[model samples]
Target: MLEVTLREYGPAVSVPLSSEVGRALAASGILQSATPDPVRDGHWLLRAGSRVGAVRTPGGPVVRVMPKTSVRRLFFLLGFSLDPARAWRDSREGTVDTGAYDDVVPALAHAVERQIDAALRQGVLQGYREVEESALVVRGRLRESEQIRRHFGRTPPVEIAYDAYTVDTAENRILRAAADRLLRLPGVPGLVRRRLAHQRVRLADALPLVRGQELPRWQPSRLNSRYQPALRLAEAVLRGASPEHRPAGSGPLAVDGFLLDMNKLFEDFVTVALREALREHGLTARLQDRHHLDTAGLVGMRPDLVVRTGDGRIPLAVVDAKYKVEKADGLLNADLYQALAYATVLGLREAHLVYAAGRQPERFHEVHGTTAGPDGRGVRLYQHSLDLSREPDQLLLALRQIAGRLAGATHDRDHEIPVR
Candidate 1:
């Protein structure tokens, strides 16, 4: 199949493609926009949004959208967001070596393959799954009600339910599904595919998930602790990019690919990191905390994070994470207005805007007439920047500093001390 590469938020590039192919690619939802080139016929100008990774159109070019950040950092955000407490610190699933692969798809494949290998080192995990089947003899428990309805009290075939101790549990099935998905997509390195194939073979006994069905849910506990990391990554893989089918009359083509939205990724990572850091200061955080913008509760709002005091529902600080590329004019004023609204609804004197650092520096604006605080300032909207290119540790450190600022503001408010 043909292949073309584009960069996320990069300048639009023109690539030669048929109308059908270009339309299918655009409909696949991997790029920001794809249109026919003004001067060059049979050429399409493609621009990428925050969503990155690769998408393969049915019998068309494999359109890959590369992230602006290094593969290492992107995976770091992914791993950290998947499970903030353990994904990075103990398992290091996010820090897996991606130096060998330049593309996100291969890097994801490499990372997942390594995690799967680590998970299956001790052999496939086996657990008891409740199963139902029609059998000649009763094993665990006979379904008398069903037997009466179906067989009219026949003994030849019995409808029974039993707990089967096998490797066909949810965890193994997820692992199998993820590997299968990666294998079907384009751009996976041959060696990675081979290794993934081996993992699939090892998990052959596990039932593959049915297409278009929701993933089987699994819970974390001491029993499946060894498989938690791989399971988390697998679930992310399965859910991240869904199959975007090409419109009909395209010759029965199936578009298969995976994509991760950096906007959601950065927001999750920042909010989760902030939540974890707040715990150390004896504070609590709610992600996507829901509230109403109007007293009548007609207009609703959900801030990225709301810091609260120890198990209390009252919010102390409101935060919104913006993963936007810098423009020449400067940061948008609409972000400030959004923060102001959140602060006003939460009845707070200040709000926080956390953005991925680019050309903008940290600053705060005071809005007049929105609140009557001790300093007579309406509301304070502080804009903070997190430089994503920093190492993971430095990133977390930056979050801790932001958390400290948030906590300090809360303390100052409680004592009627004006916050600078």
Candidate 2:
């Protein structure tokens, strides 16, 4: 029997595999690192080369493939399944391993259900019972049969053994939804293809249902279409996928990635995603510079992007793009002072600040001229933000709203909202 030990127990419980156990769980194309593939156990095949256990001549430890998993890893794997769209989008950072889907997903339906069943008896899953019955009067009855008014009641409802404190709780719906989609994708190859499709294929969706069918080796529209179709339009790309081909919008829409800069650490992503996202949005974008250049004078200035749409009418729009999980004093202030400096030199009417949208569309406007600068310049500060929690199409509208405000009064609001 495999000895189960708890590695962590606060927010969620985790189990670490001993060398003997880690050796027993090995597979290809899933977990390439030294870390164990906690996502899949069927990849549970032992690595005879690594462990200190007695084995027969045939490299035999009789590794009876545990054909199943416990709730510990089942829910854990389910957690990966939740929001797989976001998961896969983030997977490039090495945050996600292929094992969870390739090896673990198949064995789960049978094993995971049983594990949940076992837990049902202990905690969250125990069912309640309610019974209604009639009662008769006894002790105080005045001789003979006496009428009685009494009743008993019990209500039964099923429960689930849930760890409310687990990350699972924070991501329960996400896990359930992702798991459901994975379960349903077995017969829907097209859906999976679409999910994994390339931008050209999606952009070409209107052109032809030819992604898997054949390549348009010589299709003219491939080079002519103004819109770049999406492989899988997701939260990460919701704003980027906005299909407006205007003077401000037209160009080869690209999915700029730090693919070569992939990092396992989560914080590493914040900077890369922020800068790349800013550039992709046509904000003040700067690519990697190799030479040891001097930024002394530019250390703490403002206006990441400056574009003047009209002829010599303030030749640029000063913009600063900010990326953060949450905004605090340090965050907004950074943009504020930066914009202040930019406005001073450029002589622009206003500066636009942008931030990523989280759960909803939120905005904060800051007025700078409230306090006088050393030289007494009329400094006005404002901050605007977008909530990206809405659908992709809606996010586009939000971006349009920002682009409109920056475009200096040409944005139209009369059209009805697009139903898409």
Candidate 3:
């Protein structure tokens, strides 16, 4: 798979695939530049100046820039230029392109701060502070000379120990620019704010590198993958409502259902919803039992979904839908290998390994060419995830992206677009 090793902690963790790794890089703010890995491997491959896995994606250049988070929370900490990815690139061309990316973390931080201030003003999360004024006792000395002993008198207490609620010494520690404000920091790109299992908004790791020392301190944001899951997202929303909590005996996080059959979990409503989403985009796909060639004495393979544009149409793409969370990005490697095998069978030049974004958003991947196709044509791999939770606008946009790519490739890579 994608061998990801840290530059400093290179031996601590070498993951094959991960989205958490991407978030970590964003928070570190050490990389000079960030891009996707040029090689094909299971890991969410990312590359930077002497740094790899800086912003890893499933299979394309669009890496997961932030952790899985909530709409309301992200609304406060982040802002997209309608199509930030496209607009960010257009910023240099002209008038503050909305579709262009500025990824100015500080700008988003200010926007978030304003949103939070508005919310607070509206009593969304309001708190009151009280400070009481009290008189202070001052020590004074009477005349010590014998001749002035009779002149000893209590001097008016001078203004000592002054205190005011409006004025503070360490104001920055208690109140400073919010994350939205800090996001304006030149290097800060996208910021995601979410609470952790500890019921606290993760400010930063316990050992935050600050002031040339690793100190436990507050930060503009945090980097955590556990809170990036659906269950965690749910908990963040339904907090304070002690609805039936999952018992500890429930065991570790796993596929929703495993008592009956493991693979059957992919046949549930979630999977169906995903396929429906693809179809709504004008792409027809369905799950069917398709067996790979089984040399009489050899093994064979089975795919969850054998999708095609239509009959008489060489399958334009092979897709394998996954239901795991972003943390389980490792499981994706096997899926990629399986999909590639399917592409080989149908003589397809590309295959899409799709994922269902339970609580996260869609992660875009660039279209890349890999091994040769059945006809000795170059085979490419693409990765995409459907944001089941996003509005229709997102789905439409995603559909347009795929259609545009296909239309573009026809002219240069092929004579004409395929017709089913």
Error of 1 at 31 (Å): 1.0
Candidate order by decreasing lDDT:
1, 3, 2
Q: Can you write out model 1's per-residue Cα lDDT over 26-111, one digit (the tens) per residue?
A: 77666788899999998999998998888876556788889888888898888888778764374333545564787888998988
Ranking by TM-score: 1, 2, 3
**How does candidate 3 fare on TM-score?**
0.28
**Candidate 3 off by > 4 Å:** 1-284, 312-314, 325-332, 357-377, 387-420
TM-score of each prediction: 0.92, 0.31, 0.28
Off by over 4 Å in 1: 87-94, 242-251, 326-330, 359-361, 409-420
lDDT of 2: 0.31
317-401: candidate 2 lDDT, tens digit per residue: 5666554333543235666666665665666655655654333233333443455556453444445554433333343345555
Report how far residue 217 has shifted in candidate 3, in Å: 61
Q: How far in Å is the alpha carbon of 248 misplaced in model 2?
A: 42
Between candidates 1 and 3, name the one with more favorable TM-score.
Answer: 1
lDDT of each: 0.83, 0.31, 0.34
Better of 1 and 2 by lDDT: 1
Candidate 2 segments exceeding 4 Å error? 1-304, 311-314, 325-331, 358-377, 410-420
